[model samples]
Target: MKKLPHYQAGVAVVTALLLTTLAITIVASLFWQQQVQVRSIENQRLQLQKKWVLRGALDWARLILREDGRGSNVDHLKEAWATPLAETRLDEYVENGRADTEASDATLSGQITDAQSRFNINNLSTDGVINPKEVIAFERLLTNIKLDPSLAAATATAVANSQTKKTTAPSGPSIVTSAASASSVADTSTATVTNTTDASKSASNTGQASTDAIPEVQFLRFTQIDDVLSVPGFTSDMLLKLRDFVTVLPHATPINVNTASAEVLSARIAALSLSDAAAIIASRDRAEFFGLTDFKQRFPDKLTDVSANDLSFATNYFIVAGKIKLGRSTLNFSALIERIKIDTKIIWIREL
Candidate 1:
């Protein structure tokens, strides 16, 4: 009987400990769930707030671009839109003394860049045909940047093939006819030496079997800088180096003399010396170019190879980049805007 009482006490002690542990576990689990719910709510709120802030910045850009269209028909670095916002407090832009309502911790900084200032990759082809002149210009640009000039033809041909490729329905249970095949070329000139045939025919001339089919990804056209990833040999390093000098636009655009870099100016004008390009950049600082005639008279020597069609003093496309931070969330965006005679429209926006 004494042993029975001791054993009963031990059982009671064990049962109490198990109950205590179960209670603690339930409380801890409930607390963790509450914490997670609070955090999720905070994140959602911050994301929504960040989205609105970025949208406001985009609207502000549209207003500035629209004002430029109403006032000046030309685009130059001297203009207000070309000047960058130098990390100003977000509240500074809020009008009507709304600083108390806006978040003070956030900052605003961005710039409107001239899209036409860079070489357009789309210029590689015109009306579904390879353009010899554009290929030469791109080669010169590559050479100026210390990249292999041979990459110009291959990149252009790939982009051209993507544009002209036709898609068909699947013909079999396992596989079907694809729109086009894109493969590596051993020689740069094999695909574009004559520039007379279709992109597929050019691929065939490389001595690869005509019946050989390789998978290819096609785009209606290049829309962003990263779109060049689809082109063979355009590695990340190459794109990083080229992004500063090239852009993709919906339509062909002439180079803006007042905004183009020295390298671009040198490449676009045949036989133009780098020193001459520097001189032009310096001359623009003294006075803004209002017309091609003004640009011509300033650099008469360099004008021999360039025509009026290849040059411009104005830009139709501009990129607006904006970033905003709220709490632990941040949002960044790049928008391409087109302005024509007081009418401004956002063509596309890419979230970064």
Candidate 2:
């Protein structure tokens, strides 16, 4: 039983320290691996929950469409559906896993349109020629609502200026003979002048244009509404106020009086006063105008300017939006939808 040398003792101490360090490193590595595994499991669980929530939205939409009985083709994907999503409470559905007897927030929210309506400004630039009716309608819209007088004038001037730029004929145009060409040019000029004069006259008739004028540009989309910023008197504040009420759709769908908001009705329907628009919205809470006939009955006086041919009850476009929260994650998605009737079944047309 002899005692170990001092040098040997030092070596033993160093070996003990090294082993202790190795053990700690192994324990730390194991702890980190366990944490990673826990995180992975949590993420998977959240993803599944999100999927369920999304499925719930789809099912809710289907149920609403079925109840409406507007045909299976009711455009459930439109903004009307999304408007209610944010306001709906999901507690009952999440807790019971079924629609409850009490009206749920999710149920109520599934009914309103939230997306911006389309205004179809592409017609304004067709073959580089603005449709005269559209021009008249647009000017009337501006005038009907008493939009910025300067903006109206500027837009008119821009349109007129754009129309006036003339293209010169080729120098060697002997193919059709000069006399015929001259006659064609004279007729063309006369038609152009007539159109310009007619548009001005129509604007005057509608009381949409003033004798005095300014300069401005027409917009075609929500993003392009900002183009008014380039106009001399259109302030950013004014454009912001107007953005929510306007849209540019791929094709024009006349405003449905039943669905049109106060802003839209005021701008597009000449006979609808702001008070009238407010009354319509108020009436919607108690009973919606189920069809154009119903709307006509409600506002018989206003119906004079709105023809039966110009009204619609069926809507083709929709916007669907979903918000999901699962565990620690939240997600939001929005989609535009179109209703297409195929054979006997209706289909929702989605972009991508």
Candidate 3:
């Protein structure tokens, strides 16, 4: 009886331990769930706040662009809008519990860039046909970036194909059958009918068998810079090198003489060399190009054939790129802003 009581006590102790362990596990799990929910809510709040900040940044950018356009017809690096915002702490902008203690370390920085600084890929082709001059320019650009120059033709062909493709609705059944295919031609159920000859039936069958059917093709349009990857020769790495100097805009635009890089300048003007482009850039820094005449005077020998159609002194498209560092995370974004007659509009914006 004494041994039995001790054995029962031992079992009771084990049971109690098991129950305690289960209870602890349940409690811990519930606590963990609550913690996760709290964190999720915090994340949502942060995201909402970030969106508000982005909107404010966009509005500020628009104002700057509009004001800049209103102030002058000529845009240059010296302009206020052209200046980059350094990483400035947003502590003053944020509200914390106390004036001295900071809850989040937030910083904002951005820059306005001329999209025309790069070569627009849309210029490569026009209405399903390649432009020889633009092709040569793109070829030079590829060579300058140490990529195969042959890729330019493939790129142009892709762009042209995209433009040529028609988004036709589901058309009615085509007349795939030849004139001799039917055995009898009748106006209606009660109308007079003429019988088709055996020779005609044989001709129809022969015609179908002799000629192969041509399949219809749907080409992909270029909407963004990465669409170049659809071309046969473009690689992701090649794109990284080319991205700095090339862009795919909505429409064709002339290269901006005031903002184009040395490589772009030389490529744009076939007669101009890289060294010549470098010299022009050196002088351009000293003086803003008020017109094509100012640009022409820089390299008279090389720019004799160059006209207003090929180059512009000002750009309507501007890219606003910015970074926001908040707490442990950093958000980088770029937006395309278009300035037309003192009015600024955002074409597109993306987060990176």
Top TM-score prediction, candidate number:
3
lDDT for model 1, on a 0 to 1 scale?
A: 0.80
> Where does candidate 1 have its weakest 10-residue lDDT segment?
179-188
What is the C-alpha lDDT profile of model 1 across 61-120, one tens digit per residue?
989988888888678899899999887676554332224655566666789999888999
Model 1: residues >4 Å from true position, as ranges?
1-4, 91-103, 164-220
Deviation in Å, model 3, residue 338 alpha carbon:
1.4
Predicted structure with the largest lDDT when compared to the true one: 3
Per-residue alpha-carbon lDDT of candidate 3 for residues 252-352, written as tens digits (9 for 90 to 100)? 88888878889999888888889999998898899878988777776688898897888988888988999987665578999998888788889998999
- What is the number of backbone collisions in each predicted candidate, taken in the order shown? 0, 18, 0
Better of 1 and 3 by TM-score: 3
Off by over 4 Å in 3: 1-4, 95-100, 164-216
Between candidates 2 and 3, which one is better according to lDDT?
Answer: 3
Residues 282-334, candidate 2: write the lDDT tens digits. 87656666676777788788767776545555555444555665435665654
Candidate 2 residues lying further than 4 Å off, grouped into runs, are 71-250, 283-287, 290-294, 300-303, 307-310, 340-352
